[model samples]
Target: MTSTSTAPGAAAGPDAPRPAHRETLRTHHGDTVTDPFEWLRDKEDPQVIAHLEAENAYADARTAHLAGLREELVQEFVGHTQETDLSVPVRRGDWWYITRTTAGDDYPAFTRVAESPELPRGAGGVPAIEPGELLPGEQMLLDAQAAAKDAEFFSLGGLAPSPEHDLLAHAVDLAGDERFTIVVTDLTTGTVIDESVTGTGYGLAFSADQQWIFYARVDDAWRQHQIWRHRIGGDPSADELVLEEPDERFTVWFERSRDGKALVLQSSSTTTAEAWILDLADPTAAPRPAGGRRDGVDYTVEWAGDRLLVVHNDGVEGFALAEAPLDAADSSAWTPLLSAGEGERLLGVESFAGCVALELRAGGLAAVRVIPRRADGSLDVEAAWDVDHGGELDVVELDTNPAWDSPALRYQLTSLLTPATVAQVDVASGERTVLRLTPVPGYDPELYREQRLWATAEDGTAVPISLVARKDVPVDGTAPGYLYGYGSYEVSIDPSFVPTRLSLLDRGLVVAIAHVRGGGEMGRDWYEQGKILAKKNSFFDFVAAAAHLVDQGLVAPDRLSAEGRSAGGLLMGAVANLAPERFRAIIAGVPFVDALTTILDPSLPLTVGEWEEWGNPLESEEVYRYMKEYTPYANVRPVEYPAIFASTSLNDTRVFFVEPAKWVARLRETVTSDQAERPILFRCEMVAGHGGRSGRYRKWEQRADELAWLLDQLGATARV
Candidate 1:
């Protein structure tokens, strides 16, 4: 698809191409709805492909003026980033694993070096390395750039080294379909030994003996429902089926415990979960249940020394910590180690030989606390203390402390202005040392500032907003602002650093994150208050956030823009309908705009499993009506809307391209707004999936395009 050349500030090009409409009747809960654009769901239809391509051409024509700006932004990203860099090495077994990236390569190379007395731990128990420098005797494990050289799209699913560190089992997806193939390599000889497993999910674990590897397999609906054990260098057809989840709502996953003594197999739904323990010593033994699955109770188990550390949300909304003996790890054997706090959410627990790190959230920010361990490895709760982050908005969490016996704890810290930093703390003496700060060649943190603001929702609930901009940017109402949000599935959109965002902030734009409901930022109750029957709260909360910014005289409403992706994209659609006049434009990426319809069809990927998050509309009349009230596609009326840009990928299994394609079509036909002034644009990535692109450069290009369009809409295009 090609577009006609259009100069900056040019008139609308040849009227946005419109797709043909065909009605399909969808009946659920005794209600029949006519979906005019439902035919777009058929990806195989030639007409559908043509219509999408036409939309693509139109979008390209409309945004052609931003070509220069896009290029400049891309350059800014490249300049700010240290093109050739090395990640802080992580120690596991006898090796120090390190990832390296070259100046122009799109992917990173994984390699490891054997531990030795010559290469001692530098400051804070981390290796001292400069940019592009390699540790001595470093051997190549996987060169992602080399592996992705021939594929249009490539994703690394899982990389697991055997306990003996002789075999490396890795999974790769070349089609962006999320189905991966497991390949085993003899690390000692640098040769591939097995390519026998295919159509598997994203996790892999090896038996302690290194003879077998366990992986998950997805069903036709794209749910990971089966766990299989494949012998090293054995035929895929003879792989043993370890377990299969019969319930559609549940998905199976397995991971090696922190201690590396057992493989923890988990079967989880949105609101419930259970785990099985497979002793690594006996890979063929029957799995032992840690706890029985109870409705509405979610828990995760990790082996900690002689006991099991359990983080569960049973009697507590924000979750609590419990401990059980490894021999009798049933629910009845659990005893409280840390009781639930009123305003704090216990996210998870990571155990070390000398201490346990509790990753938790409190006051709308992430923090970590360390509890000293007794001589026998049980947590000494009375001696616990929270880590001192020393920054107002710094987000701190436990990093990869893979070795159970390490005396120090590694944690990462970052905020809106600060780049990512890895630091370690001595558990016994509480001595913190800065290990390595991610190298950003030309970034100056001093030029940026971060602030926290709370906006009251319509129901009197306070939503937190994190704002970041150039230090010189004023708080007056004249500046343009971009608000972002994602409030679904308890996923918290924390304040973190992004180098590319510098392009926006440098241009005098204020970028903010709305920590609204349905997110785990506050706690479990925070998420519960915004999902299912209360899902509309997410939309209202976001609209309220925009209104708060305008009312606070921080940003001009007419110059404000908003963006969200996936579920957040759902937020964008809902708010565009709920309060179109509150902003200048909206960008929805792989948006779940057609929520009710997708959730009603059980055959769709993630549909049946989403019943707990979004109530089942097929079985409940109330759910049908509730979803109908705010679902973007069904609620589109002949009302004015902000300039809308929706992006989707053809192979996106999570939020199918049809959702956005249909939503954009409805908006073009139904909105009463002037198409020339507030044109609705849709871009479909023909060769991509849920995430638009794979390689770093291609991903950055997509970002630059979106940012350039947003800058244009906000009238902040001129580089400051």
Candidate 2:
């Protein structure tokens, strides 16, 4: 593949040509003090007006092309997989059940297994192997006959009660566009008493009585959702919009207090959010603001009789679990039960068997059973369980989306390392039994290892990178390494197991996750350093980490590949443009490469929300000029570019597919690389959104395609 000329001050190859532009781009957004909109506001100068109009026109055309490509890609990828749904929901008799659709089927079958059990013993005093198991050290081949018999799993769904009073379980149904549905099951009769109610959007919270269901639904305009309440067993037509924003710009998130007396919701306007409380009895009552100027708050509500235990942000850093008298109409009645700190956040709360259980994260997962102050006015921790896993429990792998039946204490205890199977902490006996360790199939934990490494960026900031590879791989720096990063939105990329990733490591690949700035790895400060005017830090940190790997002889430039998604896609595109020779191949998946144009457009879902990450171009000329310089699509020049694979989704409302589409198109037009040999493939998923596909098999296929592309670039092959 032909490579681009090195920028001024950039290390150059022996044969590489130097670029004319030697100066690095300035990215200070605050330097331009004057109104950046002055150019648009004053159209008297024909040259300025013409330039603005041309840029606007180009942006509009690109957006339309992207939208069209999204639709086309969705259609193309839809037929590649059979319909299948996967879900775990609590059934009657407190049994946890999993439901899944048969290949090519629309409906799901459910399976029920006791939360506590032991396999039947076998001959000769040796434990017998179950249908799903094989002899020790042997590969467990899935039994076709057993799979057919297990097809009855979905039938368990039919056994749940559709009760008017029972709290419904939320199930994510994949056959229907992967939407979540709420259904109430009768534990006694083993039948569903209520029909499934489709969820509004992503979030869902149930009321105390199980009659009222609170959820957020998307409307026509912006991507924000309005909180709605639906009564189970009541007329579906009677569903009420409990809370909504008249202005389309703001978004609201709502949840019910454990007692169901008050509805707590957060209304966010751009970067700021305000919490509000509404009386459940009086739906027409105006919501009272709970706090002010709080950037964000993590909370959960639990009921202790008539009072509410609210884990709230008290206009301070971190959070505190407090108590409030719900009997009063005033929100001021709330009082803090526990102090807030830099690392304190409430994970879950459970009130069962006349005991109030709370799970908190101070240093590690801490479970404390609280005895509400009797009429005597004294508080005490009835029982406490401090999860001392010695950091062996990988908190990064815990699913952010908690299960419906997730215990207030046990969930917090096992909410790490790929979702613990069962954390059986007996409050009475103080005995704990962890059942069925969650396994990343195909991964031998003994053969793999994880380590934390820090790389110093150009700005002298230490960027933490997580490295995971086969322990068997020689440290002699000969392994093919893949580095990944996403440094936007203060979203921390935690350590999670991906089965496909193991395939790469098994093939002598060293995978590294660069925890760069503009991410919340080290908390808010780390994020702030890499966003807005400091956004260049994100790019620089990634490049620095890649350089560190090369300098350390962990991987050579020609053997290293960088992979990123969404904003990380922007990172991949920028690094590939800024230092194309450093990476062997670039996989930019569902990228936001056309950052400048997308930020300028008001029609995009994340445009307004993104002002915090990428400064408002309309408000500052410095931001506009800086973004224009590094904008992936705009930055593609006539040079020998690295081999690229840009993937896009047709239905992604966030980070629309057009970004990658336009990027690939621009690279094809600008670069002189051979189409066949140094291919820049544009693989668009026609039916999927931000997530490629719904089915496991389909996702595996996409992973295979991606891995195949990377291996092909590295001149490696999947061993048959």
Candidate 3:
């Protein structure tokens, strides 16, 4: 899609539907290049679905003049959301569950409620799910707006229930790809006992004697390689498989062990892992492994009490906490317990039957600690603590404890102007509580104000960012910022709260988040100096956090704006080709902008397991010239960039949608900008995936049509 001079949302005029180039050469190591929009990567090309429906009808006739500022940013994201809410229920043993949400249901119903000795257990044994009656024996599990009323892209994936909760299972999907479809039901004869599993891939468990069910399938490069089992009235062609992961770089699944007595199973990759276990009181046994695979060793197990915690990075690289012995067999008999500290990073390890939470990441946010359990039940890791969460750039975490003999714990906190809460500490007298806070309606965390700034990069390194705004705006230099980013797997983009970002902080804009260098925020050596050949230090720490927010005048060197998604949309296409005049609009979502033609094609779908996070440029030539030096569709040049947009989806499956449809057809044939005042747009989505259109008011009308075109390119559309 690259030649145009008109025919896109054509009212027969203002041009821009360029789709004609068909060059395609792609050699490698000895460098052969020439890829003119690689035939828009043929999605069964009917002229590549008519050039992605004529670039979504030229991005709906160029934002059809921002449809009333995208319906006032979807009614200011439904007037700061809280529409008939519910959540905080949790329990999971004698039932409790909850989920609710009804005001204009785009999905959310899943009820439960049964542990009755007639109510009363509030604060931590958590019973009070009040509002509008029905508690006595409640029930109705799964309405998901009546299973997404005949799906047009629902998603759920794994729900699972049956530990005598009388069966349920769930799964579904409906074509936002990640294949699903399990079903099962029978919660006390509501019937449908097993839709015979179908494809499957987002985890599910149910075996502690409900007779089998496991799941996790994928492959054909959609990875999650095998696992299976089935049987509860089975015959999805007599299921069974149980573990296949023949290393196309790992990726398996499993779950069930917060004392449901063993399931774990894992596998993983992007730098090694392995874990198995199974047992569930022998529901046809056979999972076993707990350790073995090694490479750069990574671990994961859980079950605490009679041991088996794990969490590893084998001889430590910012992860540690061992334990083993539940019929041990690996890491040469584990043991340690916590160790790995210096600049922290831990990340996960839950356990409960009184305590053992963890989850860490230091110097750069996220906390949640706990330890308790030592009257002889074990894990007093030097009596651990930290759960305060009284903001130090708040993030907190460790949520839904699912009753592993509930000594409470729960967690969650938040930041970027609070509104998230969900407390409940007490891992033996820490005594917190809160339980539910998220109601935002007209949010006013004292009219916002968050900070933690920093920046530096180009090898000097520093980074950080975060920001948030509207504490009476005025960050001199005329505000209007926006920022956001993602860096890459070492994930960590924390600070939560989003009632549609209070419609970009009540419109004065600002916002922020960089935390760059392949983010796990300052931890595993800040993700080993930003990955493979120091992946251009995540585009020079996102163009040095946009030149330290426009040289500290705090944004507005032309109203800023930026964003990311999917590997932070490959760090927003390498900072829009490394600083395309410091943005005035960017976006990128589901991007991964043709990273060296999808990592030099190892037959695509997750390109050879993302060669441990983008490196094996098909047998290195210094990883194919270090991924063709910042592969944003081979570094599009002709400058003058900004105002881009890009979005993708048409069933994404991990950054596909032809890499933002050949990077908006090679920036509409190599940028030099001014295509009628900086327009690049391209959108796509048509029946979504890679997180786009999937109910919840179609994801708030696709985030109010991408924040009404990023509040009309950060001039901040209307509302004060």
Candidate 4:
């Protein structure tokens, strides 16, 4: 293992070899190699030979172990995997059920079950029924499965009584390709209400009366998305384009006011976001600016009665919730209802029954804040509930996908030392209840605890790290660890629950989340410091965190595994290139390793939009040089790297599947050591994009594959 200092600015010893200067090589296939480590040609060096031998031995052992467990993992996942074929549309009352083909080559089927009034329940209770189960009052529609190789439910929202009037929406690839076609069906009469008369639709919103539907469609060229409004049971000609964003780099998100009198269109360009409001009463009316734009404001709006609740940065560093009367035409009329202060970073907000409920950071801790609306539109501070302690809080955590109703919010919270717990917090009483605390079946939470530590980056910036391990693991500290991070896009990888993660934890493995720069955990300033020219900070921060853990006796170098996805994948790849001996296994999912080449390609979906995140390579030579410096795919060398698993989907539009495909191919061909073991496995979701598949079953299958791979690497076994 390579020994390094945890403290910033620590000088290397005189005996330490001077690092080599590397150059990148560009191939005719449009791929670029940034750091070709030519100095490693003399592999006879003791240091190089030792590193290569250890890596080869580990790889050989892992290969044999994985071969033995592959069949068992597959069989275990298959049995535990539940079939999800029923569709539950948003209904008027308690229950909303629809039919779907469950198993075998049987005909398309139907079923009925009560929908959970509060949280979204899985299809565990819904029983499979034949066609005879359909009542005369109920109706069914099965579109001719032509070119519908993977026809499945997209989204089941808002249902009407009659067959001709019921609204069922889904994004399907009727062309038998990856491009999606938005389809809205009237299940009552079994007819297609709308089938994306325009181009491919991405985001959808329906008016309160359900008469008007607003959606954003993606097209080629300048205007990537156009927001259009269509009336139900109306002619296609009646549909009108409400907002046309001519800049292909911009994306639009629209939401109707609670009363449906106003529509808010948030136009997001590369780095900036601007919102505009339109009067639905007057379709031809021009949209008025909604609020002032902040440099790193990722604002989301919500409506409560006659007022609009804005979760935005009021030209401040962090986020806060503000409010303005819906009747106010001027954006300046918006008033600061809540201020962004220490521990007041607003994470989420929901409006219910004339009250605004919020999830925020208070006192450097995760907490809930509520404000009740008065008759005149002003708000009164209702209550505040602290979810976790400031010291115990994982600063870089985010909520597990939450499900909420009007009066109660249901969500799961997980921290470094804590298993995920499904909790329900009542708005009125400020009472918090834990519904389900994630358990490893036999393992106990009392045995594991999380420790929060801080390390300094090369620039003396304080980086936070969360380390989770079994309590029995001696503080004298000899433990294997898995470090994870995704320090880009200002995204905070907050603590969340994953059952598969238990496979590592139960085996006395320590899992750590490195809250590196380039993420939103510390604030907008932190993100700005780690992106673009300062992007190298992300790599160094991860390395510093790892060193901190080892210095603190939490783990040894050879026992650590590094993992990341997408931009985080880029982080994993770059760190591996910089210090391969620090980790045992590296996992890069849908990795954007070939950053320089992808940025230069205009044909990619989000390439132009990324100029704000990664800077424009086409226009600036400086950016071109900096991007090449950290581009993972461009930095591959002949040195023996840790056992690597780089995965990508062929249908992924955001990062382009070819980046990983090209990267793995190059790694396999160029690398000299079979000991490094570049297992470039490509799991192409033949049916989906960016996000694997639409159905729950399809997603679990993917998860199973990932878990199997992780288990194989960690030398852990899955629960049978």
Candidate 5:
């Protein structure tokens, strides 16, 4: 965009491609906001599309020299990874389903084997699994490579099999848009049943009879407001609407009950929740609400035999476990089974034939409690893991507990330095078995180390930080480091090994994660303290983390880089405005930098739904003022910024591409001219959305480009 700011050392780059600008004014609550780059909002406009193409050309010219390095990074990552890999099989109904990714295929192949004898214990007290090959009578369920053959961008959504195992209803997203088309097939005959049903959400379930499908239908705002029932062989236009949520902020989705006897419609917003149950035996009846909606309280329901297991945060700040008769007439009948302790947060509960499992988090760690009876009876269970600092991860989660009659619960454990390990535990005996360990061909865990560190926030609050590095990288303030953070939506960024990260570790660089207030790592309280009016705690905590690393002599002032995606990108932009000199470079992927403007507009996709997480500024003048004070685009000034790279997807329905497009435009117009060599690069994927390109190989190349760019800025050469 063509705009001028003539403060000391502030002007556009000599070769920067400037997009044409048109003046636009927006007013909210008597406040005037000017946006010159608003013309770039419409992707369909020829001029708007040309500007993005020009921006891409400029970015290509700048990073063209790193082409060789990008290829090398891609090769190094591929070498470390097990090209031909098989996922740990899960028992479902009468078969054990598995997915495999070959060396050159863009997608995985889903297959299943006939029910066999129970796996016997091996030498190491683990279930025996043939890691490389399938057993006899293996049948192909769905080949993703074949499904994606016709589309430039293909993403698989729901893949649900009928209770009788004769029909499969799978969802496919051919465009980067989140909406999917579900195709029903007769598994026995291996043929498509009829025309595909389009505009369906990811959550789709089949009736036990295998004649109908229940799915969530997304509205124009990308919200799942209606749940529909579609007949497999009938016209999708004749699909019945089972429920329509009146509250726009709340979304509705359906899932078949454990016994496949009913369909559950779960609806929730940022702070409240409600559930409805539909009897599958009588498809003509409407679903009835489980209980009256309670404000500021959230809960979920699961059926075990004739009892309804409920996990709610009604009376307890964290959460508590309760139960009711399947046909309970009143909410008061919810019998409190267990209450969380001072620091424990009862996350959720999973029901099975023999036992019920509880997922809990405390002191920034995660664990799962397996109760043999109908309930655990108490909040505390003896099935806790003692975390090992050097070798093991602190988080142990309940993973793949699919069968209603399973005798064992499958869980996973991982850390910053360790690859994921899938384990199984007997419900009755509580004896744990290690099932599989993902193989990374050329990497050694012993050569690297990971640790949890704490940093003090301004209010004396301690923030958790996860760090990993090569043993040779000394804390002498000479090595380069990359710090990452995402503290919104109560979404915890836990530690999981990434093979691509080896390129940084072997190159003598340190990687760290700042577990700040907005994340659910600690508990509900931690998340509460970081959102709404307390949202700034996230950005401040991140700054404190960077300062803590420097004070600990782990990285130099000029060698430290930063990264954040989505809301974390909002954090990156805010901190950059608040303290620009603290970081040397930053990469924000699909960032939400235009926070204040987005929140004030109610018609946008997620604005109204997100008002609970981020308060509505349009109705409150105080909130509008506060949001204005910290909003990144609103606070752009003439200053020397860190080397910046912002990425966006044209079809990203979550955070619109216009946000980052406007942000990079403003930065190029306002930032110091002396920093011209420090590129403020912007890259937009013309045919992708929030998750980016679909294929694994495409994703790897994209990652290589990003890592190479950051590595070049850090002055750290890749050793491999």
Candidate 6:
């Protein structure tokens, strides 16, 4: 974890550590690939530790000239952000829940006020809760900053209150791993109870009467596959196991019904899903599936009034809405509430007292629609989002609506040039009430311009790209560009404002996101086209986006930098191998470069569960060959490469630190050293995990370092 920097102004010249080769042969499908740096995967070995530390030393030496720039970036970030801020208070049954952040603190403070019994709405069509407004007689419920004072890696996972508001159950993970410790606090006495469940997932739901709590537990392979229920005062070992899933692919998400009388859990994989319901009134009952689970079908269910409201794709191309009797939780007995359709994708649903909110995406843009419930217990779908629409890169989804009987539907909306704003829509009149807009000091949204562009892929597919830059920066291919992409797991990087990007924009760097086929940006079809045997589509799409940006005169090829993290890191690696000349530099954080090697072994963490997403390489020779062809570690060549900055954490559970460690080591040995002064830096966080450094200050420092490196590689002048 310790490293020495080179002399000042030495970044222009390189002095890097050359790791030794301990060749390891990996044979599969009657083929062998020699991995000379595979020995670096052994994290416990002192030799491996020394090599990682030496790489850290090399990175320190390589970026020595940017120390001043990094500091200046950090200071600029701090100036534009309000360190001390307050979130809009949400009112529950008997408490006004508020989250407050103090300057210089890594976490926020969760508090509550008891004076509010009946929630009040704004009269002039404004949000009732305003930022920084104080509620009388506030009580400190759980101060995360204070709780995380002693832990180096602290994650405030689940913060929930009992139905009666007397018991507060919160989970914390101190090791950067998602496995948390559920701690119960007696809110009546303002003290933490000794009862706690260790090694549990970050999910907690209290029963209607506050007698039982449902939480998820991670299996040996780090999958949350079990739901356990514990009595308020019972021992952790004596907790009841409500359900145990033997399937390794599906992960379980635990939740309580709006009425809090039943436990609702959804077990889902990448392409298929199923839901289970257990009446919390009877703690000894088994959970029953909401509907039959069919392969290639994904659906979720929720309780509203006397029936189960379902969002499924059984008969529709995109998805449809249906409802069934509470007892008959099967597809046959379900009646169509919103009929099947195309073009408009049914995202999700949330029920309130008077209406059901539908999150729908049309033409790849998201919006919230209100479907009011009639007196006869039916939904009005004519009021959907098809009425009027502005097809822009925007996000609209259901926000926190805890009260089952609330009259309004709360939602959050944001776009590329707009900060996030919380709003509540009146179900009847559709009047909007904006609660809060995130603050960015000394900044104006009008100063920037954002646009959505299409890039033509090799196969004639049009991939979407979201670009944002300062209006003053000329679009003449002379400005530096930062291109980002993550095309895996059907996870979409939606259009949202990022204040931190101002540092790059003001420095004349254009930021863009390549929404390739693997992401859910378009629809499920988009994801299917980029996974399994067709995974190469994602890599090719990214390459096309980079080329399109250059063709559009946005940035020169030699001035563009590409960056991605985790699975996105895999994207960066793939593109680096496919078209190294397109980018001047690449930043990979906790990258999954050794995909074929990891998937071939089932014993490693997350490998077995990832079979469906990346294909089971151990069983299928075709899958093995396909993965090996594009796997970054397997594809390193003798060609000249871009200046690379690879980072990984020792405790990363999802993407093991070994992947990046091995990739970096091999790149140093294989890639030609003719451009020796071109930096190929590796950074290892010894005490962190997949998410990198935990604290805000530490993460800011890391971001600044990355920006400094990026500016240096792009030949951009620092603001300082």
Cα lDDT for residue 602, model 3? 73
Mark the 10 consecutive residues where model 3 has the least summed lDDT. Answer: 1-10
TM-score of 4: 0.75
With a 3 Å backbone cut-off (N, CA, C), the pairs that clash in candidate 3 are: 1-19, 2-19, 2-20, 3-20, 4-18, 565-569
Please provide, for model 2 over 117-154, each residue's C-alpha lDDT reduced to its tens digit, 9 standing for 90 to 100: 45333321113333332234321111122323422111
lDDT of candidate 5 over 1-720, digit per residue (tens): 111122211223437667767988988888887788888878889988888888888778777767787888888888987888887777788777888888888899888876666554452333345645765678888999988886779998888888888888788888888889888878899899954589887798876666778888888888889988888888888999999987888988777777778787788897888887788877657887675588877888776657777888887878888888777633686888777777778888877787778888866777777666634433233443322223434677888877888778888887787688887887767777777878888888899999888999999999989899999898999888999999998888887787888888887788999998888888889999998889989989999999899899988888888999999999999988987888888999999999987888788887889888888897888788888888888887799888888998889999998898899889988988355557888898988879888898888998887887788777775572
Error of 3 at 603 (Å): 22
Give the number of the best model, judged by TM-score. Answer: 1
Candidate 1 Cα lDDT to native: 0.87
lDDT of each: 0.87, 0.57, 0.80, 0.60, 0.81, 0.80
Candidate 3 lDDT tens digits, 468-562: 88778776888888888887778888777777887777777888888887778878778777888887898888788888988888878888888
- Candidate 1 residue 513 Cα shift, in angstroms, is 0.7
RMSD of each: 2.4, 10.7, 24.8, 9.7, 4.5, 3.2
What is the lDDT for 686 in model 3? 69
lDDT of 2: 0.57
Rank order by TM-score, top first?
1, 6, 5, 4, 2, 3
Write the number of the candidate with greater TM-score, choosing between 1 and 2: 1
Comparison by lDDT, 4 against 5, better one = 5
User: Per-residue alpha-carbon lDDT of model 4 for 1-720, expressed as tens digits?
Assistant: 111122211112212112234464654334454544433323346643443344334333434434434444434434432232333232323444564544331233333344444433432222223323443334444422332444642322222232213565555443222344556666555678777444555555555456666666676532346788777667767787877776656777776554446678887764666677877666556777776555655676665656677777657656767778765544477777766666356766766564566776543335555566566646775444444424466332223211223455544566655555556556566666654444434445677677678988778878988777777766555666789999998787776545455556755677888988898777667778888888999999999988888888888665677889889989998998887778767788878888888777676666787888888877877888888888877777887766676665445556655566556545655555443233434344434555555444455555555655554454444332
